[model samples]
Target: MEMLRRWLAAGLWAGTLLVPVHAEEPSVEAGLRVSRIGGCHDCHTQGFAETGGQIDPSMALKGSPVGFMGPWGTTYPTNLLLTVEPMSEDAFLDFAKTLETRPPMPWFNLHYMTEFELRSLFRYIKSLGEPGEPAPEYLAPGETPKTPWIVFAPPQMPE
Candidate 1:
């Protein structure tokens, strides 16, 4: 009986050694969790943010059609999946760090997050598999937008 137990253990060990170990894909769930907490779905999901709905399946990370107008310019969120599809993780992180975003983008939030968080988010977005429509072009303060837009109030100057 002891010899049989030893043989079984050796067999299992040898079998495990023969099998190829595959690395698990990065976690989409982790990316989704971070995205939800970070509000990536907000402006990225067309019409969803303003309506206060949860992330829309059709519009997920596809960017809003609406534009936000401020003194600096009128800006639209980019389709995240489409934008990041061509970029490596390192390139994306570098771009995120130095992004010169316009108003209402909350670009500052990205500055506070870690690289691992960004990687997870990117991995999940990449896994979505298809690209979305490109976002509207940014318009300077006085330029006309191709679509309708909401102009924000000017900053209040201190007394």
Candidate 2:
């Protein structure tokens, strides 16, 4: 009877201890969920739910070769699928905290996420494992891109 009681107690203790661990570690579904909510696909891939475009699961997280031009210059989203390809998760997390990406990246949007969410995002992107060409180099104002990825039209002014 005493042996049984000890086993039960250990089981209960372990159960309680593991809850936070499981919560902190995102499952595949959870990671994917947060990625959508975080709008990661908008810039990283060609089509995403947020832009009213169809989802292309096969092309997920491959960085955009296209460029976004603005007064700040032309910027392209990094290949998030490779978030951890060059570094460990710990290192990626550190880099994320101080991420100063170019325009339209919305890195600032990520600064407030919990570590769990960030890790989940990292895990989700890592799951993709598809490497894309690095984003085109930044073009300063007045500099012309060698291969213009996108053409712009003059913004319409309200009469």
Q: Which candidate's lDDT is highest?
A: 1
What lDDT does model 1 reach?
Answer: 0.82
Clashing pairs in 1: none
Cα lDDT computed for each candidate against the true fold: 0.82, 0.74
Q: Which ten residues in a row have the lowest lDDT in candidate 2?
A: 145-154
Tens-place lDDT per residue, model 1, 8-121, is 999999988867543334467878888889988877877666677676677788877689988878998888988898899899888778776777989988887777778878
What is the RMSD of candidate 2?
A: 6.0
Top TM-score: which candidate number?
Answer: 1
Per-candidate RMSD, Å:
6.9, 6.0
Candidate 1 C-alpha RMSD relative to the actual structure:
6.9
Tens-place lDDT per residue, model 2, 62-138, is 76767777777777777676556887777777887888776778888778777777777777777775665665667
**Alpha-carbon runs more than 4 Å astray in model 2:** 1-24, 49-53, 146-159
- Taking the candidates one at a time, how many backbone clashes does each contain? 0, 0
Q: What count of clashes does model 1 give?
A: 0
